[model samples]
Target: MSDNVTFDAIVLKELNKPLELVKGIQFPDLKKGQVLVKIYYAGLCHSQVMEARGHRGQDPYLPHMLGHEGTGEVVAVGEGVTKVAPGDHVIMTWIKGSGHEAGGCCYAGPSGETINSGGVTTFGEYAVASENRLVKKPEGIPFDLGVLLGCALPTGAGIVLNDIKPEKGATLAVVGLGGIGISALLAATTFDPERLIAVDIEQSKLDLAKEFGATHTFHAAHDDWEAEILALTDGKGVDHAVEATGLAEMIERAFNVIRPGGGELVFASHPKAGDVIRLDPFELIKGKQIRGSWGGSSKPDRDFEILADLFRQGRLPLRQLLSDTYTLETINEALEDLENRKIIRALIKISEPPADAA
Candidate 1:
């Protein structure tokens, strides 16, 4: 790869419009402790869709780059870069800290609005990430699987083992069976939850959720959804409910479906400010609690390795969750597929970047 190379990137010039191919943006030169990654796979995430639609209430810097889950091989390194070599496969995570220690959530550039300040962390053919922010992929883990540990897997697993921590033989309900909902279902199985109830508007997604480990499924968009969830739990309500849809009505219902002393975990981040959900205060008095989680409260250095081992053993279904792939030039099409629920996950493949020139 040459130092003077440039690559085509899908860029959002304005909120609420289709993306366009933009060329001639120079890949950032590596700085100290930074490595230049030749991105091979970038996961299309809901956050990117939210940002493009202006659903992100926070003021996102305009002309923003859009992507967070990315994986590739290091093609170049700056002075003192040591964690990865030129050919080592790597996954880029949102966790950023100085030196080798993971720090509180901080991003390095103009596109960091999805996670923090400093915009433009990802969404390019090549990205400059700190050496510490990357975890080397095991010999056989493909780039697509590796990218997930950075966010989705940990968030879903954390909701089960950390937030809900469903006790043995407990009954659990997962609302919004999207990417994260499906993952929560699998994680809940590790605890041997007596009944894993999955709820989603689309029956196809619910059917897919059942294949992934959901013990029961319900149509949330139906008028009698609350009654159906209660009936599934045998009228006692579930011991745990996870709200992954990030909608206030869904969040409220998660509370309603939990047993008197059960717990609720809210994993999705809402876009609008002050979106309100009504819930009875008496439930709090009775020990029903709703908690918020970030990145599954994960330390990537440790949690990522654990997830990798699971992926290696096939205990965690990585590839099964993916539905489609596209080139950056077809990002709009990819997003449309996602919006229509045509795919569970869509990944963008960047191919044949120009060689760096002197």
Candidate 2:
């Protein structure tokens, strides 16, 4: 528990290439509004994949850390910190919260190189995070399950519960069954949509969506999937649509499924760089609104508690969220699994959990 901590981490030294695991990297001393955390469980997201593959464009921050969501124990706190203290279990998130904004950190690499880090990076054994990026983990939620609260739940559930705010018995459809898609589908069921539709290329995910309260399911593998949805809605469209896949065409398709009058579309997915989504200008005339969601426009300090309560009450089926688990050494495998669509969410275990927590 000293300022000179050495740990292993996944660093993106080159874009569109496998991340490098640099061991014995020296962590810098915590600055004002900073907190040092021993990372336990982290979630692998498509955002990291976007950063690693240079899909989001530009790589001025190469050899930097990757990961914006995870769970960890606060080992120490820096000056002017008040939100959380040392030894308090907390959730690591990219969503800014109520605390100081200590900027990114600089670490001394093994070979005299420097590794840049953001206010919150979780793909390592330890993290030096900004105090505003940390939120107290509710005791009712285990560390493994709490990891989802960092990004997936906030963005996924936040979209339906916060932005769209569909009325009871309304119609809704969630396209794509990845972490965010599945989370949106799970949250949409709470509203009791008259026709809660789920769409995905994989039958397994479609079947799983049904178990989580989707009234109807569609396979996007078919060319006429959108037409089928329109048919199901009697030539109309759902009141709201959530596009969770980061494909430009899918976002446009999701927008098309929205009803003309006062229909809304919210997408949480991020398409690759230079990917443009073209929409018919006439849709706007029809009262069809579309907007991109930045972490579901979530306020983590207030939302995490509400989300945690839902999880405790069994309303959120988060126990089954993670599709697979991997160690830090197998980080590449985790990313590959995510890219291949083999898993909904991959849990990266930087350090082993305690006996009871496991």
Candidate 3:
């Protein structure tokens, strides 16, 4: 196979520091179960922020790459790969799909040092990810919006559609209106929930959630969100709650906000290490349920098709969900905007979409 591809990528050289946009990073030969992707667009999520700010604990891979969800085209595939072929439009995700699950790939840094990368990283113009890290982009899905399927949809919507399976007229609330929370909120609406409440510290996010079919919106900056949510449920509580912030307190809050006797809370947050959540033993005894999700327990091959159909039917308002866009060079700024709650989901434009893709 041809082996001459050098590209630019952002590198996290130190924890709690800005990432460097190193140029002309050379690529090595693809290994077994690896797929070389010419990235077009990538989505920014809080997990990247946690890594950059040292929120997710000590980083052994300090000089590693960042980002997990992106949309691109397959440039080449390693041996034993059967999932996708060259020129196939695909969504790169951290969630594993049906393919060979390779370990990490090593890239030649600008200074000739080996830079570590996980199964997938999209903060670059091109990415070398495992075969299982991608799914064929379904027809009718735009290149940019594919980022949602990579992480947000599978995690957020997966919690409701795959895990919770809330019945029609079921009362539900989603706290922390990031990409994942909004995706869950959008999916929850299809169930015809009695109360689809959206909670976030930002009024802008809450406002957008309202437009996306949230029956009620709550501002989390105040101290009364739990009380207000309880009042909305008439002191009973919601049938289900999905928390996405990954904060320990918020996870605990979502747990407390649900009603007893089968109230369910599925949180997708990965809070800082050493952070402990204190919960009352009585809640568990009262039949309240809580479960942590691993990518919403999704099997990408099946779930992405369903979500893409939702978007095709004009049910998933992805245009509104894609809050803003930034270039690869400004990826740090994009991540900062997400951390500050300035945007819901930030899109990183790595390269222009193929003209024929339109």
Local distance difference test, per candidate? 0.71, 0.90, 0.90
lDDT of 2: 0.90
User: How do the residues 287-348 of candidate 3 rate in per-residue lDDT, one tens digit apiece?
Assistant: 99998999999999999999999999999988888877899788888988998989989999
The TM-score obtained by model 2 is: 0.98
Per-structure clash totals for the candidates: 9, 0, 1
Which digits, one per residue and each the tens of the lDDT, describe model 2 over residues 1-358? 5554588899999998999888999878789999999999999999988898889999897789989999988888999999999878899999998999999999989987989999999999998999999999986888988889999999999999899999998999999999999999888888888999999988889999999999888999865778988998898898999999999999999998989988889998899889999999988998999998989888999999989888878999897889888988899999998988989999998886666652
Clashing pairs in 2: none
Model 3 whole-model lDDT (C-alpha atoms): 0.90
Give the range where candidate 2 is weakest over 10 consecutive residues by summed lDDT. 349-358
- Candidate 2: list runs displaced more than 4 Å: 1-4, 356-358
Is 1 or 2 the stronger prediction by lDDT? 2
